[model samples]
Target: MPRSLAARIVQDPSDGFRHLPHLHTQAPDLHVSFDVLGGGRIRARMAGPAVPALRGTEHKADLGARPDEVHGASARLCARWKERFVDFQPVDDQGRALRDRQRPFATVADLTAAPEHELRAVVADLVRGGASLLFDTLLRGDDVQTAVFRSYLRSALSQQGLRIRFDSDLHLPWPMLCVAADPSAGKASLDTLFARFLGHRHQIEHTGDAYAWIGTPRTTQSQPVVSLNHDVRVGRTTKADAVAKVLADGTLCTVRTTYEELIRDFEQPHLDEQLMYFWCHGEFVGNAPEPPVLAIRLTDGTPFDGHTVRELRADYRHSSFRPLVLLNACYAGLAGASADRSFLSRMLIEHGAQGVLGPLIAMPQAFAAEYALEFITRYLRADANAGRITHDLARHFAAQYRNPLAFTYGLHGGMDAQLERANGGEA
Candidate 1:
């Protein structure tokens, strides 16, 4: 892929290896933790070399948001954010997002299409607003010098090479979280509102629960298997078809249009696949008594959740069942209030999957299809890592169409994962 627009504008020369583990010591690292309480309250804190400890009276605020109230932020129901939320159709896994945050709800009609500038404004709002949901309370004057200091300092200190992780059970779209930026700081194109998102500035991750292999990890290189949703439409210029073309042209892996076939393979102790892509409907499933778990369905509506894999898969040997799962479904990236880890992601990680990339909100099918096409194309290249691929996609969409939905997708481990092309192998 060509240099990203933001990278080109800033003249920041970056490579796929920027997020490698060895280079982390030269710069600062950040770790933020959040503990969810009985109510919608969160007990949050942060620590890093860049974060200083203050010895004074701490001013803390009782900040709590009802899960239902926060739903309005993504709803089409006439409310404060409805105007901007209308641009991209969003769905919820809860299946309970109300029509309006306020009574006598209003609805917004699409204005043909939102202009780039208007879209960027919404991007800034969503990023900064999402950040505020978590950090605004973490920021009262005493707790923070400025909201920017907490979210942007460590990243700005290291520039584009950021080694940061958000250790929280609540999988609030971490990349979409942004702090306020000075508008008059620079006149460069890279300084546009689009560049202010956390994902655009850093190599990010969540719940760094890594498993160590009990034995020597296998070093063999075999052709990977690329699996797509069984329901992908095949025609000219179709996103799923285009993504299939990517695999076909590269001879990347053994491709299959699978649904139950995947379930059957995953039930075994060892599945010989490197990358698994799902382009089906996904949502959170649960009643109030039980915590919501994210789940996906193929054409047959077979429920594929963490529990499904745990019960079906045989064992967790280092050589078995490990693959990078691209869950191109809505809300697959979201985790509930339990610190256990992501529903699907944690299960995949625990089951030896390298990493999982998915969306945090209800993403439209068209965007998900297009996103899969672009992401899969880059995934086949040896020079791009998962983190860079996702972040770069955010920049690409923002620059090309001012769409910020790409940032809604979060990286669960495997930020540094790079795949060898089936034909070319590693560079």
Candidate 2:
């Protein structure tokens, strides 16, 4: 798939000899494209495949309605999460658990664990309410919007093991958004409620327009090349060590210790890495009045944000430079507005990265480490695409260990991202 993909692009950056391995960028089974209209309104058009009723025809549906002020629905949800969990009940400096609170902490195993149930309920409410915000705010004039979205999701329920992607300008959490049925579809049972979350039910991907392109491959690679860019101070942490071990075992590992070093490396014309993993801190930095821009730190604490990448990789348009990026930092995965400056997700994607996966909030390092190990291990050794792998992980953590941190990680494009053989097939 990687080599064949290289054949499609008009420009080639490699020397006449080497090939660059491509990430999976296949089309989805169903896609919904959302565009922001003025006044928090959003317009949607379902592209490619049609709803079940309209499938198998030569018709292409452009479903649109008067959009509403969903302007910062995703932003609001993120804020709510931090306020509920972070400010009120926050993680310790090590990201262990809620800061020492007198309210009595409890794990899932404790029969009288109010905190566990409370957290679960909070997550559920956030998801469903987010769904309501997205679903309701998406098409607001009449029953038209509801009908269109519900019909789209209902048809989706029938398709097994395929991803359903959402594209938009809003920075909303696609995975956390809930799915609703029309009053007529009947009330869902408790056992079947897991399907309510778009992330759990489907291999969901939400990205900006032009989120992907054909990724190329390097024929010379014995094992994929991986780079670990982390803060200098976090070297001794379990999370950092766990990730380093994974990279060491599966691929050729290169380490970047500081923000200056990462930017300096990006300045180089060629970045041969197939996977770029950043185990650092993501911050929202800015002046007093201006909204804080998202930036990252690498022990040295210098701000490394998207602006640097956009400036450095602006010329990557024809480079065939595609690497699956994992930002295990806070606020890196929270969806953002369409304004052009300092969007970590958009900056990387617009510059030819295949996929960008990261946490939507300040994730505790404990769960983040486990999630990264599972994701990276599968990505390196299994044939599953990133989206399917994400879905499976969500289920795995929720069921096996009773952890919900998996859903906090968001995927931008690269749903079809899986290892590919030189012959253009699944590796």
Candidate 3:
């Protein structure tokens, strides 16, 4: 009684409708399609009767019909298709289709319906195979209500490792590179949260611009230039004591140097530390004269946005403490042409950083602080006697905050053991 996927797509060909590959429908007039674009990305398009044009317009139909009607129908149709086709088969390392026998849908669904740990394994397998699932939901409500529901749907799908891309002529398409992290609604101070989470007094450095620090020190041996508003004397005392205590507790001690300090230190080669932690504001410039500079904040609250991946590769190609860099900035993952790794994580790993952890979306200050504190706590407090502890720590952090659109976590290094350990021996 229901039209086939392809037929539904053909009936309501919205703008750029010819691009998708699979289509299905529950009703004759309504339909949805699954389009496999390049880069292993997939999109869904849903269409039905065109709404009537506004007063004095040419098109004629029921403008009174809500947009959700179309969207809801599409979602229902796609969910059924996913239920029908959601089986698993083995594939090669390259994600190429292999000759493995297809398993039963009930088994896969049962796995998904299992506990979170089991569901994660199944989802990881799907991602590793370069396959993305899509759901097209039709809505019958005001545009505003529809938008709210769409956001909810996006959040739901992202938790399942699926990114939601909405298509509609009524609204402008969301930016391709932009991902939204839900902010903690209200007037909560991120600074206070950071202090509570870290269990220590900290300073806030607000640099107006973004930049990368090249050949910088991991920690500052000199006294920090404390802000005046937050009781400079007390802050300095807290920082000094915290630094000494952390170092005394067998944690590695490193200094965060300013651009000038880094330049001078690099020339003299004085400090001797293997691992480093860089905490600063950063920005990703895609089409700049020098692409993808990790902007570091200076002591005077100024941003020094200079230094490229190429320069780092050429200069610190062999530095022992090339220092794994974690960029706490927006769009830090997107890299430019000519660079094998554009994302800050990949760039840092290639440029000598042992590992990196950063958000793939615009991170809210509170979330960033929380995530950073957790990572540092794990790294500093966890026993390092085991193999690949750091990598596992990073993966665990990512899994906990897995939101494909609002937040994507990535890791790159030569340490396969670390990655595997992080995966918890699953997948």
Candidate 4:
């Protein structure tokens, strides 16, 4: 018997690549055209001449006699057919060859006004066929790009019966954000302070050069200590061991896993509750036919791409324990607003996480880890008899750096509220 389409559509958790065929080959009739725009105008161009003919006359004559050479020369002769021909021949679709010549504004306008249904059909076919398509557009600015991308994503995902939810409206407990990156790097500093202000009620897990608990100052009398010295590993197999070690030492756990294990663990119905802290470095490509994945380091010293935040959202709704996900990776929370869709943090809340905290700016790796640990330690272990733990945490860190940039924290949902209440205050 043949395998079901659903079975074929699902990717293997271990490898993370989809089991579908190439999108182009699968949809031979699909046609796509590019329009390079600058200052709100189109740019017309063409292909260059073929490689210089073979040196020897006899060899050139033999090559010229070949049908391919003849066809190549003929194609070059026609201005409209100068470039490489594909399913969407400019001449066939636009009635003009995209040659090395300038065209009037009307011509460009006519091409843009052409039936977009065909283009939509091509995109739909690629998605349904299970092939990932990357739509990389250089927009005017971050805000503009984000808006356009979000709109396009909504239109695309809605066709596939998926929706992006917002975190604030969901009212779930705010999740603890953890970072495990290189310390020398400043990427994780804000994250560390945020964790601390949350009352040091979280955990800091790392596999860097040293193994010691960097504790917060208990009182003005006692100094913060770093006493434990141990070897820490960063990949998947050691993730569980690291968590176990942290728990044994009576500290909160922030475990880092291989990209493959991250996906596998998310998909599994049962998850370890004690493993509360989650962090990783991965790519999040939205609206692609292939699932978005977190690129993680493997046990064999190779890198693997795991599933997207969407896949994780689905798993969270169906799983037993939905761990709060702190995606230190770039573009993780980049889902923009369009119709009813929200960002990745919102998706996590809808599925199962209490809440998610990530950065809006590109973070440096080492700094990200250090700040994350510091924040987690302070929040999980600090005195929070005062009110507004989450807000205070954010504020405290902001003050320490004495820079507004240091307080760049975006929160989604009630997880922030939960943390505040848990720390003995109201939000």
TM-score of every model?
Answer: 0.70, 0.78, 0.36, 0.35
* Local distance difference test, candidate 2: 0.65
Task: Give all candidates' CA lDDT scores.
Answer: 0.58, 0.65, 0.32, 0.31
- In candidate 3, what are the lDDT values of residues 243-355, reduced to their tens digit? 33443344334444465554444443333333344444555443565444444454533444334444434455444344444454543432222122234454445444544
Q: What are the per-residue Cα lDDT tens digits for candidate 4 across 1-427?
A: 8875754546547442332213111111111111323333322111111112223521110010222232232222121111111133333365786563232111221123333443233222322211111111211124443444334432322231111122121111111111211233233343332332211222111111111111121111122111111123432332334333433354433343445545565566554231134344434334565444334333333333333545754534545443334444433332222201224455555555544455433343333444455444444344431113334544444444322212223343222212222233321
Sorted by TM-score (best first), the order is 2, 1, 3, 4
Best candidate, lDDT-wise? 2
Per-prediction backbone clash count: 0, 16, 28, 38
lDDT of 2 by residue, 230-300 (tens): 88565355555876788778577888888778888787767767778888888787777666678988878
Q: What is the C-alpha RMSD of each candidate to the true structure, in Å?
A: 11.6, 7.3, 23.8, 26.4
Off by over 4 Å in 4: 1-248, 251-256, 272-279, 284-319, 335-343, 382-389, 416-427
lDDT-better candidate, 2 vs 3: 2
Cα error, candidate 3, residue 314 (Å): 2.5
Deviation in angstroms for 120 in model 3?
Answer: 17
